[model samples]
Target: MTGCQGELVGQEVSLYIEDNEGNVIKDEIVTTQDNGFIDLWLPRDHLYRVTIKQGDLSAESEISTFEGDNTCITDMQLL
Candidate 1:
């Protein structure tokens, strides 16, 4: 839901999210939907660190949910 801006339909990946202060938010395994996306609800007005993993490949990015910030984040690339 937060990274890998490409078609990865039905792929299962590990998700790890944390606040800027190092508070853990989400850490679990999730599957991508048919649209190559996942659904997540995050608190507003804070910056977060997002990491996604699929096997040995992984991606990481920084995201925010503040007002006027982009909600749909899809720019991380799995390496």
Candidate 2:
């Protein structure tokens, strides 16, 4: 990890989709840009698991998608 103040820049984040039966339906890997943000387009109408790891610290969340679902911000902790 880049020691740029423990920022999550250029970090690989995984956005995954699993079926009700725990089968992976779709998976995506996104890297944060210089602005410490990832611009991605995810399919709507599905449930997803998003995960990101910076150094030994990590973050994960479960999200439910719907039509017109555009953006999601779970936490804000970066310079």
Candidate 3:
């Protein structure tokens, strides 16, 4: 993911995967590197939401659903 050079440096981000019943299946926390980048691996046939928290700034991506048997990547920015 790419963002304004001054927007996402040294931030705390989190990824969460949940099922249709809203049960949390997986969760991960990551710190944005110098490039404000994060790499994620997700399981197939699951629904997920990614939340990014940077100090008092926070943002959450839309709930996404995965189809095929493959991994996916997502990028989020905290406003």
Measured on C-alpha atoms, candidate 2 has an lDDT of 0.60
Residue 79 local lDDT, model 2 = 18
Residue clash pairs of candidate 3: none
lDDT of 3 at 6: 39
Q: For model 2, what is the alpha-carbon lDDT of residue 12?
A: 77
The global Cα lDDT (0 to 1) of model 3 is: 0.59
Give lDDT tens digits, candidate 2, residues 26-78.
Answer: 57676787867765455677776655554565566666667666465536342
lDDT of 3 by residue, 1-79 (tens): 7454434566766655565667776676777768656656555566665565655777776454456533433344567
Rank list by TM-score: 1, 3, 2
lDDT of each: 0.89, 0.60, 0.59
Expressed as tens digits, the lDDT of each residue in 1-79 for candidate 1 is 4445458889999999999999999999999998788888899999999999998999999999999999777677779
The list of candidate 3 runs beyond 4 A from truth reads 1-7, 14-17, 26-28, 63-75
**TM-scores for all candidates?**
0.88, 0.55, 0.56
The ten-residue window of minimal lDDT in model 3 covers 68-77
Distance from true location, Cα of 79 in model 1, Å:
1.3
Q: Report the number of backbone clashes for model 1.
A: 0
Error of 3 at 2 (Å): 12
When superposed on Cα atoms, how far off is each prediction in RMSD? Answer: 4.0, 6.6, 4.5
